[model samples]
Target chain A: MGEQLRKTPYHDLHVRNGGKMVPFAGWSMPVQFRNGILHEHRKVRGSAGVFDVSHMGRIYFRGPGAVAFVNYLITNNLERIGRGRLLYGALCNHDGGIIDDVTVYHLGDEILMVVNAANADAVWKWASELKPGDVEMVDATSDLAQIALQGPQAESCLAAPFDAAVKDVGYYGYAHVSWEGAQILISRNGYTGEDGFEIYVPTQLAVPLWETLFRWGSAAQLEPVGLGARDSLRMEVNYALYGNELNTDVSPLEAGLRWVVKLKKGDFVGREALLAQKKAGLRRTLVGFEVAGKRLPRHGHPIRSGAEEIGVVTSGGYCPSLDRGMGMGFVPPELAEIGTPLAIDARGALLEAKVVERPFYRKGSVKR
Target chain B: MEFPERLRYTKEHEWVRVEGDEVVFGITDFAQDQLGDIVYIELPEPGASLQRMDAFGSVEAVKTVTDLYAPVSCEVVAVNEALTDDPARVNNSPYGDGWMVRAKLGDAAQLDELLSAEAYQKLVAELGG
Candidate 1:
């Protein structure tokens, strides 16, 4: 709208590779390439695909109080996250509703938080406003560009250019490495529910590094993926997208992220509210649905139990892996059973669907 | 954005080809490209009556869902049921196997109001080269 706003470091590279650029998270990002989203999505599921996730926000909390500050801000138990380890967590409002879902990296004395790009400024401001003594919050989002190489062949593909030791980096773990004279943080973490590494390097070095990865990973069948594939991949895994499954109104507990909320971890921002909710029990929780018919349920589509509206779809799409219409949405706890029948009000028509378990396609290398 | 010279197009990007009274209908190549991947398509039921420019079906991609509009009023005689399992055919062959529906046109005069290949190309170009 406003001249289409900003572009990532790989903007020109995307265009050259026949990527269709679209506005997302306030940045111009490639949605798909010449082969299309289905091809890109299958590429990641079958072999390997590299995604330019540079639009995600990266913030560094440094100094002696870094650990304490992060422990106080997020709901996850930071003390349990050892050095070089990463933990998925959430920044919550006082009401226990999520401000943003984030991944925290315990980098020794410092803590690095990666948040949704759209919530970058909001997260930074919230953390700064809470500015407890001795902690320094720095917005490192612009300085870094993230590349995610995900799939079964991800390790072998990334190991070529990166340190051979990277192969041993366990899931949700990271290691600092020197690549082409630049410091890079390589994390064995991804949202695609696959074995992969999220490499964070200097923005100026993004294009060259991307090219090197593509060239070396070619034999491994690593393709340059776009955001469209990334979304479908995550959706298939039932990972919550910020605006979709998570928003100002949805709590981590309601979104099936209760494992991330540490009730025993002394104190945190939203501890009191979550503790209260835990006692009262969740009214509506996120659940997966697979449409029985060809009609796909979409965001804002109402979920019904006969004549009553039980819930609404937060994220829905046709999963290429399953060859079915799948979605994640909030539903009454009573209707969240694995095989419960539900109807999706897709516009004026009612589409038949059934509740299903999370990670709809589980033949992934996520834990492997 | 290939609009075949022999085909007539709608503003919503559907292409209709006349073969006697039966008209073959499919989305234009431009529509397929813009939609990215066709993951699911809800085709109109056989013998269903449709109005000109009305939504006859819908297509779902990974991130978005779009309604497929009728180019002209007709009765759906056939639907591509193969799309239920392999909807990517729309991307692979929008004009051939990806043809969505075959309908008997209610009025052949409506074809005159559709866009020509040159006109559709010009419209797409003006929207953005």
Candidate 2:
């Protein structure tokens, strides 16, 4: 608490735009603007919204062993995706507990790993100790600034500013675009579950790029969003947040991220433990539930079934787009079935909730 | 943010008003501004008794929750039902239609303990409002 919080390149811009700043993952970041989180959330779902994602750590890997090294580090099969594409996976310890969930971007000669800001140092330390002689690592977090332009109008919002055919970027695919002497990487991906683009720009060009996007996107109703809306937007789609759904105490399999784990692709850091856990069967699994009332179910709230205290809430809050209270939590497999009735202890009040499908909102345009 | 000159206030950021035999209160504009957009509110039912400084209700913003403290000892006579469907009133009209609870005034001396608008504004300024 005595240490000074890190600030992103857009810190001044955010403050000038009426952003309500808060401490998040060691960074002084905006939780919402004057329009508030609800407006920003709906803007992303209906039109477009831009977010400063520079706080997330970006590490670039190169050399002949880059591909092999990343494959060994993550649970996903890198062979499944070719150059210009990215895959979501988790980095786990030998005990199969997740260290952090990351998105690995394959760029042919170089590979980029985007990690959670809170676990950046831990992840870098873990990778550094396991680095091969032929592999090279570059922590480009401070050197670059990232922005995510998202929603139904994302393509139109981004098309006019860059040289590349922004609409042609496939989901999870990226393209290198040159803009006014600046080299930028635009990836057609986002955490909001909307059709969007994540742009990685040089730190020096970050402010200009952000202003340019807004100036060009003004016609498309693009607004600046913050972490408050960002959290709710991802929770609506049942995305697993690192510290909440995944942590040193939780396994990827138990977190309902099995699709990213390719055990058949040969050896990985947590392969043996994952295999052992698979054989033993999971005792608890992550499930999404919707509360019957308006009370926002918060993290660490106790989950009760009849008279027994079963589990605890990981990510829970009011989903502004859905206009309801929903959340994700880990519970016994039998209790995770859809339609299972549950209650969350919010303070002394019990909020009624029921287990539902994986995603609380299924109308996202990410795959469109 | 508007602070009504007629109302008294507490350090917790709640504004108080004495209306004939009843007293009305709500979170101050500064409190609402600090809380960002309010999403939900939970207040005690009518006839619920509360002591001075007791938590009688709660206000829920998108990212956080804050307890609403009582300004003085009283019996809750009525709660603002409008907030049940539109909690944003706390952010939009904290001093007007957004009032939280109406109660029969208790221990008139407690009213003297509440800060006047001038004094409340000073408190807010000291808190870096």
Q: Rate the local accuracy (lDDT) of all candidates.
A: 0.88, 0.92
Model 1: residue A331 alpha-carbon error in angstroms: 1.3
In Å, residue A30's CA in model 2 sits off its true spot by 0.4
lDDT of 1 by residue, A1-368 (tens): 66665778888989999889888888999988888787888888889999999999999999999998898889899999789899999999888989999999999988989999899988998999887779988888889899999988888887676656697789899888887899988999898988898999998888888998888898887778988889889999998899999987988999989889998988899889999999999999999999987778888999999999989999887888998888888998988999999999988889898998888989998874
Angstrom error at residue A322, model 2: 1.7
Residue A142 lDDT in model 1? Answer: 82
lDDT of 1 by residue, B56-85 (tens): 888977667889888989999999989888
Q: Which ten residues in a row have the lowest lDDT in candidate 2 chain B?
A: B1-10
- A160-256 in candidate 2: lDDT tens per residue? 7653567778888998888879889999988988999899999999999899898889888678899989999999998899989999888999999
Q: Which segments of model 1 are wrong by more than 4 Å?
A: B80-86
Candidate whose lDDT is highest: 2
Interface C-alpha RMSD, model 2: 1.0
User: Please, what are the lDDT tens digits per residue for candidate 2 over residues B6-89?
Assistant: 999999999999998789999999999898889999999999999999998899898889998999999999999999999999
Every candidate's DockQ is: 0.75, 0.84
Please state the Cα-based DockQ of model 1 relative to the true two-chain complex: 0.75
